[model samples]
Target: MFPKPIEKSSRSTQLTYQALLPVALLLWLAPLIAVALFAIRPSVDFTVGNYWGMPSSFEFFENFAQVFNSSMPRYILNSFMITIPTVIGAVALSAMAGFALGVYKFKANLLLFFMFIAGNFVPFQILMVPVRDLTLDMGLYNTKTGLILFHVAFQTGFCTLFMRNFIKALPFELIEAARVEGIREWQIFWYVVLPLMKPALAALSVLIFTFIWNDYFWAIVLTQGENAQPVTAGITSFNAQFRAMYHLMSAGSLVAALPPVAMFFLMQKHFIAGLTLGAVK
Candidate 1:
């Protein structure tokens, strides 16, 4: 059962909750706040061992300019190249697979669906070595295509699960009506089902975009340089051999965070609708 609403709690409990909420919120935002502060602080501040003190001077524009003038832009472009294609490919394949599994009643349907779901359970770290070798063998190592293919394949499982459940929740009567109207299955899928699946597609797009954009482990494992490396990996370029450029790294981190944050805000309405679509009776 759900916990009682805060409004229904005793006055003392309500006051306590209200008092603790902002404190908790600030605690959660503390790291991000620190990073933002570091991004604007002059390098001399860190050199003088002033980690927590007020910035000696703000170099916000200068730091971001340095990040942009470097290969950070190329890294961002590489991320977009890998992530966008992966999102489209995974979503397309999963939508078709989900339709088959959810709309049709076949002997092997559950088995196939279970296989897709099973892949999601397997630890990705376990496959890293094998995937790297396989990519090399296929002559795809250290390439955007290689990363895009891997992401699409791995993400398809979760996308399939999401799509299958969303499609399943849709009214079967719609499919029946289309069939009764002499609509071909593919036509029904394209014209009827695909239109209804917009919310799920939007939600899945945002999720996959975030996942692939923020990926650092695979980026480092597979690619070596800015030619194909994502912003997550490219951020390391800010580091010097003798010393880490924490200020530039912080600026890069903030810059790297912008796209996903913008994406979520832009799609906020659709994302919320997709999540809550089936909640009501």
Candidate 2:
């Protein structure tokens, strides 16, 4: 909807558009398609002489076996360790902050809300030094906890903006009726607001999971090795070891990409709902 749809053009123009679609898609997916194809290609067949020829033998099992038996398992575990805690902490903090800003009419409400909104847009480098120092000072440097804390704090800025707007759009009458029933502030939040936040929670879970899972910068800055490094950093090390092993690298990339992909597939509905919540008037 960002760009207005084009009306039916001339037959020649339509033909041109149809012709370009496949070319565009192929261009976009060329790298992935090449990787997928290479994953099944025998190393002999993948020689420069036959890179695109019909694979002489499918080696997907062999490549996947190597990847599985390699550092991928530890990386997967690390990614989950970092992603899950960050998602929970960011969502939980944002939910509470969003409730206060959405429900209260304090003079600083908008100011605080905009502060979070603006924070999300700032360059991450500005906070890197301070955040890393804080993590080190806490003795969480080079640990999963360090990565989780930074992710939670950084992601909370965006999540708070999202949840605040989402909560604001809910009917005020619901809170009013609950108030009339003599519900305390915490009870109103727990019973009336939190229950209705299911869709928002699901949506954010998928989004944050993918973001944290794919994170590279903070992972490198905070974590050192397989002990605490997530898949992105793990992949960097993998790439170094397997410099000439394209098939293994491809398989590793696919494995690294699978979790977020699965999460999106599983929570597609909630994700879409959260994203589109404010699209309509």
lDDT computed for candidate 2: 0.88
In order, candidate lDDTs are: 0.87, 0.88
Q: After superposition, how far is residue 232 of candidate 1 from its true place, in Å?
A: 1.6
Error at 163, model 2, angstroms: 0.6
> Number of clashes in model 1?
0
Instruction: Write down the worst ten-residue block by lDDT for model 2.
Output: 1-10
* Position 226, candidate 1: lDDT: 71
lDDT of 1 by residue, 74-160 (tens): 989998999999999999999999899989999999999999989978987998999999999999999999999999999899888
- Cand. 2 TM to true fold: 0.90
